[model samples]
Target: MAIFAKRALLSTGWANNLRVEIEGGRIAALHAETSAQTDDVSVDTLLPALANLHSHAFQRAMAGMTEYRMAGRDSFWTWRDLMYRFTTHLTPDQIQKIASLVYMEMQEAGYASVGEFHYLHHQPDGSPYDRLAELSDRIMAAAVETRIGLTHLPVLYSYAGVGKKPLETGQARFGNDVDRFCMLVDQAKDALGNLPEDCRVGIAPHSLRATCSGDLARVLATHGEGPVHIHIAEQPKEVSEVMAGLGARPVEWLLDNVHVDANWCLIHATHMTEDETQAMAASGAVAGLCPVTEANLGDGPFNGPTFLNAGGSFGVGSDSNVLISLTEELRTLEYSQRLRDLARNVMVVGEGSVGQTLYCGAAKGGAQALGRDAGVIAKGKLADLIAIDCQNPALCALTSEQLFDGLVFSAKDEVVTDVWSAGRHQVRGGRHVARDQIVSNYQRTMADLLAKL
Candidate 1:
């Protein structure tokens, strides 16, 4: 058994200096206002670690490379072209290296878990590897090496666009029929079964544009029992196309079609109407909001106050991995709300502090979206926690609300001094323990990929 003492911050509220005991990768007991004994381990401020509800780990390498001006207006579709070209040259080994680096950065940035929207399945030439799930195996390996809790979402990409169009060359690696996708998911489940129980498998139907209604239904029917994630209404163009092609807006059409619920995460519902937002909130689905990426991609601002008032749930993600910081993501989210409503602290719940409100809401939404019993420091919950450096100037005079505000608004990834996932210390002193080797491997892989590109 291991014991840790700190000012424990539960999702619902905060406690004074406390002692938490862990055994068999779960919290055994928690004692409030407990004095440390000679045998007890001591920590600083401890809070439940955040979960990145959406990510494409391989996209970490493509950060900042796609910001140049293209011929046209350079929308999300244009950015997709760059992403496709970049993804074409990656081998499983390269993917593992990059993913390890990304996951390490996430751990250091105070995210204990990641919901990886992994879709790269086949070789660049569109042929199956000797092991169909080789890429997923590499992702799982990376997560194990980095020690970040993983929700590996194997994405099903059957068609290129609406109406069952054939996948373009760039999308070949991500394409699989429903049956083949299910097979790959099973393979992934088997592979992940060898890892710690904190690692899980989920299904992602890439988007409304990528899969037809029948294909979506079949994939859901085959492997919809676990968490389900999908990109929806990220851009105005997408909303227009989805409406023009399907006779309904993306969110409206999805609500009419799928059984979206708490187990589902609707990524980037950025262009939802007020009615669509309200309906989404009532549907009990978590919105996988990536404010940094949305701003980077010019996807426009989400209706934060409207959605929040309508009882919408949301969790932040480092979607493109251009920037990976729990603090930055949360900050950008609140800042977006500020910019939208021209008001301060627009997301705060009743008499609740802004930082506490954001943290608690994201924790609950992220856990619900990932289908995990996490995001809370309570009995029977997974032991995923992050410790802030009390010595940091931003944390000076840290009350509960101030501590959260400092962590969310002022602190960067470097201030995350320690992190624990499943009662294991994966990060200490603001660094993943294996950062050197992981970063070295990533550098080599990135060098080779860049040389080829």
Candidate 2:
């Protein structure tokens, strides 16, 4: 198949009359200043679709449920209790329904893939399903149905707190010791039996408070070159606990202990000190930042200026799925930094506009974290692209060079008109192909689940 865009962002910036050829879900070749072929699909503008580097699919059904304050002193701990209660009721069918809606929404929002940090492994009663990969299979089914790329990060969550503690009651569904966790991962691979080449399997150590160092090492041994992701210091309470238990801050301890590198994605290292920031930057790992969720949870903003100045790489995610928007996440990341430094354009890389810098940086980091040959519109890469409706009055006034700035900052409407995920046209006219069915299932599932609560 071939697509011709009047304007497109290429490896060498914006080009006109752009022609991209795709074969078997990968870009075959690209040509600039080319005439449209008779069979080519035409588009206004083409942008590289990005990966949502972190997500919890089931949480999408609970986005607005926890918005109100439950108590006078609402915090992440309190919000988590609600999450635990919510996860206790979902059946495999309901899980698939929620995930299908979530992945379809991501596809429409221009995210070609998601690294689902899945931990809901067992039944509500804390019993393992007959098939260890039961929940994983549901997630994969949703991916197949939605036609979105899946980098399933089966979570290894053992303890509820630091220092090898026992699993808490609310954490029952997520519990698995090292041996069981390994078995689940293996069975997940077997269940993933035949999938698209773009689908990948990876492991996630839920967090420092959720697993011990010994188990961390054991899981890393089983890791066969797939990406590794972990939640680091996202809150002051978490850092305090790590200090009391591990005798160092989370980032400091991990830097000293784990051989962190390009393959690792440390999610929300928000509370790193200056020293820790420098060390993390030098380590070559992508700092997985979900600024919208950080703000939602009142988790402190990461030290973006210092981290980037130290030569760090970073990516954005729709964590919690409370809201899924590429522009919102990227904008929030820069806005938070601007507020921190009390200056504009704090996230600027070098010479380009801040919007372009944020997109390109997050693009590279997101691709690295997902183990995908995407995040760039180039030959031999995955043909994950989005075309925006330039006819929108706000977008229509902008020049090709200024399109990103308008889209990222001031566009007032849903300008995205079409999307392609690894050569699959999952979204058109700003809606997923399977949106009607997925929405119907999701609404029914949510109503039933909420009525019981």
Candidate 3:
């Protein structure tokens, strides 16, 4: 058991100099400012850690690798081909090393948990390993080593596209039929058993382009109780293909086909109409926004104000992981909104600070999307928290709301001084405790991968 007093900020509001008690990796009690502290108590300003609602951990290795334009047009489709080629060379051990570094970076950036949208399964030859969940086990092991709360989402990739076309050679490793996918999910559950109790297993259908309607239905039927995430309408071409092939837009078809609710997350719904945006908002599903990746891929801006007004929810992700920072993601999100609408504070509601509004909304929506009890500093919740350096030049002279504004708008990841996940200290003084070794290993792995490439 341990107790710490701080200016605690809850998602609902704030309390000054509060005492938080922890036991067995969960919050036991929270006391307001007047509470007395014992001699052994420690105090700091505590804020609930952010959840990275979507990530492809392995993609961290491919950062900046595809920047140069090819002879043909460079777009998300072209970039994906490069990604597919890159995935072929990675062994499970290499994946573990890369994911450890990725998770470490996430922890340092004020994210205590990550929802890994894992789709890499099978060997490079498209054959199952002796242990079907070898790749997933590697991810779980990395999560344990990094102490980041993980929601491992095993993806089901049945077909090449909506019409159940055969997978291209590059996609073979991620391909799995319905029965095999169900078994893989079971295997993934067993693989995650070695991880902390807070680690969870969820389901992901890779995208509208990767799974047929029948297969998608089957996978969802098999894992209906767990969180369901899918890539949807990320590009104009994808929207056109879905419309031509399925007679409906991606989100429209999804809402018409699936029983989407709070349990569902539609990643990269970047190219939606106003009606589609409003309908998605009314469906109680989360928009898994990845602003940096969207910008990187030249995907268009999301209709933020309209969606929010329609009662939509959104959570950010470090997709592609060219850069990883919660503040950067939020900043890019707001900046994108400003660029599109030509207005500032475009996402804030009545009587709310822009930064506070963004933070609270992302936190709550991310928690809901990942099916985790996080994003708030409350009793009975997992003790995943971050402490920013209030004394930093960007944060100095800022009140609670202003602090958030400055942190989001002015500061970067360097301001995140301390971090804890599931009541375990993983980062202190703005660095991961195992930063040196993790970085060294990651460097070695990247060198080897590059040598082979």
Indicate which candidate wins on TM-score.
2
Looking at model 1, which ten-residue stretch has the lowest summed lDDT? 3-12
How would the candidate models be sorted by lDDT, starting from the highest? 2, 3, 1
User: Against the hidden reference, what TM-scores do the models get?
Assistant: 0.97, 0.98, 0.97
In model 2, the worst 10-residue window by lDDT is 404-413
- State in Å the error of residue 371, model 1: 1.7
Model 3 lDDT, full chain set: 0.87
| Residue-level lDDT tens digits of model 1 in 190-264 | 997767887889999999999889888888887747799999999888888888889999999999988888889
lDDT of 2 by residue, 1-453 (tens): 999999899887889998999999999999999999999989889989888999999998889989897648999989998999888888999999999999998888888888999999999878999998899999999999998988889999999899888998899999999999999999877766656888888899999999999999989987869889999999999999999999999999999998888889999999989999989999999999999899999997899878888999888898999998888888888888888878888887556677777887888889899888998899999988888888898788888767777777776327888888899988888989999999999999988988888
Candidate 1: residue 129 lDDT (0-100): 97
lDDT of 3 by residue, 1-453 (tens): 454545778645788777777877788888776664564245456788888999999999998889998897899889989999999999898999999999999999999889999999989989998988889889998998898999999998877777888899999899888898888889989877688888889999998888888888878777858688999999999899899899999999999988999899999898888999999999999999999989999998888888999999999999889999899999999999999988888987656788977877888888888887877889999888888877788887898768788988999889888887878788988899989989999999998999999
Clashes of each: 0, 0, 0
User: Candidate 2 — which pairs collide?
Assistant: none
lDDT of 2: 0.89
How far off is residue 258 in model 3, in Å?
0.9
